[model samples]
Target: MDLNLESLGFTKEELQERVIARICTQLLDGVGYDEDDNEFTTASQFHRQMRTSIKEKIEATINAIAEREVLPNVASYIENLTLQETNRWGEKTGEKVTFIEYLTRRAEAYMQEKVNFDGKSKEENGNGYSWSGTQTRITHLVHQHLHYSIENAMKDAMKIANSAIATGIQETVKTKLAEISTTLKVGVTSK
Candidate 1:
């Protein structure tokens, strides 16, 4: 499937920038003190530091998703598909060809103009080996499955990131308001 991110009113780059900005703002808002135990004095300085931290975090998240989610999902799908195809071939041919050999042979035939299997040429195999029918169906199924998996993975990542930012913002706001209320109470008592 062709994914036109622009249809969502933002390009990938724009989405990345927005996410970075939002996460940085939330992180900066949560910052109560510096290394010297002094409260953050400058919004600009806090934002700069938060931007760097958020960028590193975004990179880490990307790496984690690629390693933990996308790769594993694709590998699992490929494995299952290969097994299904092997079983189908076995049932059709009534030959006990090893799965690995079957895959290798299929790959080789795909690279050639004509597919020859079980001593039968493409013509002898009817339209089974043609690119229009079975081959097209298998290709379409794999494409659709992979596309859905990847889209879901991306949505999950975005949801997690957004949730973290929102939580940080809420916590920061509560802490700052409590501090202000305490300061006001002390001033009133002193007067």
Candidate 2:
């Protein structure tokens, strides 16, 4: 079919060059594949490029789908919580608590539970690392505050004891002096 090339914006010379390339070296004895070796080379290059492009696109699509669909499920599973809200004593309370509220209750319980400072008990029963907000831990507050208070209290106790002892000694001395004066007066009268 003699089709005009001007309609397709192509020149006759360009079409002739393609035709000449196709006519080389291939004898179609029984459907010979290569007109030239360039076809196979071009196909191999196209196959590599197509495989790379498809693999990248497929991986990107899978990642996007996972982010959209699976991540929320994973997050929900991690936060697995009761449908109804409960108080510290496991009784049904007002409204349902969210995950943050649940965690806060747990944190409060952990902090409120009397922290045993007994080193022996800790050595006997300790497990994994313990964590607490520094402000919540009494150990931190006590050490920071009461450590100096103990020394001050001891000093006050010692001062009170010393004052009591001094008062007792003064009273005893006065009593003894009064008894001696009375004995001298009695002896002087007898003389």
Candidate 3:
């Protein structure tokens, strides 16, 4: 009454072993053969981690560029003006004035009140002031320069991040593949 499994090319026990081996291999490789025998790959933890890391890095880079290129220029412009002789004479004789403080106050007043060439106040134009005549030309040039600087910095940061991420991923994949290959070789040799 014993079953002759060998006549079926593989014994029942051998068939079970083969199935278990295939499952173990699929688990290690992170891919499984589907009902159609097509390979389906799963997302690895490393890939998820890389995506999160890249998003954080990009946000930090944008913040850093804005802080470095935009804030200081505005601050410097507020700190460098000297009081005109007419304004100086109009001040009370004994009043001692801090030049930086004075200039900052005056700059703030100008920004709040100044109209652009189009006759729109700074606040009305979304924090952009329009100056008249030569001053208008100068302001436009400065605005253009600042805009270009910030835009260029962002573009450069993106380019650098993309290159770094590409290189990092490539190197990581190569290292992982080498490790897997070495492990497979050792396992085969040991058995």
**Against the true structure, whose TM-score is highest?**
2
**lDDT value for model 3:** 0.69
Mind sharing the TM-score for model 2? Answer: 0.27
lDDT of 2 at 179: 92
Please name the candidate that would achieve the greatest lDDT relative to the true structure. 3
Tell me which of candidates 1 and 3 scores higher on lDDT. 3
Residues 18-132 of candidate 2 have per-residue lDDT tens digits of 6666543222111224645434333355455666777799999999999999886986865766457678999987777667677888787665555444321232346525632
The C-alpha stretches of model 2 lying farther than 4 A from their native spots are: 1-52, 65-96, 118-124, 127-191
TM-score of each: 0.26, 0.27, 0.26
Candidate 1 per-residue lDDT over residues 1-191, each given as its tens digit: 56687877898999999878756544666544556757653457667777778889999999998998888797556555533333544654345555566788787655443323233345656766452222433454566688899999999999999999999999999999999998884434553
Clashing pairs in 1: none
Steric collisions counted per model: 0, 0, 1
Q: What is the C-alpha lDDT of each candidate?
A: 0.67, 0.65, 0.69
Candidate 1 lDDT score at position 49: 75
Query: What digit string (tens of lDDT, one per residue) describes model 3 on residues 62-168?
Result: 98998899787876655664454445558544444457867677676655454566545545567544433324434655677888999999999999999999999
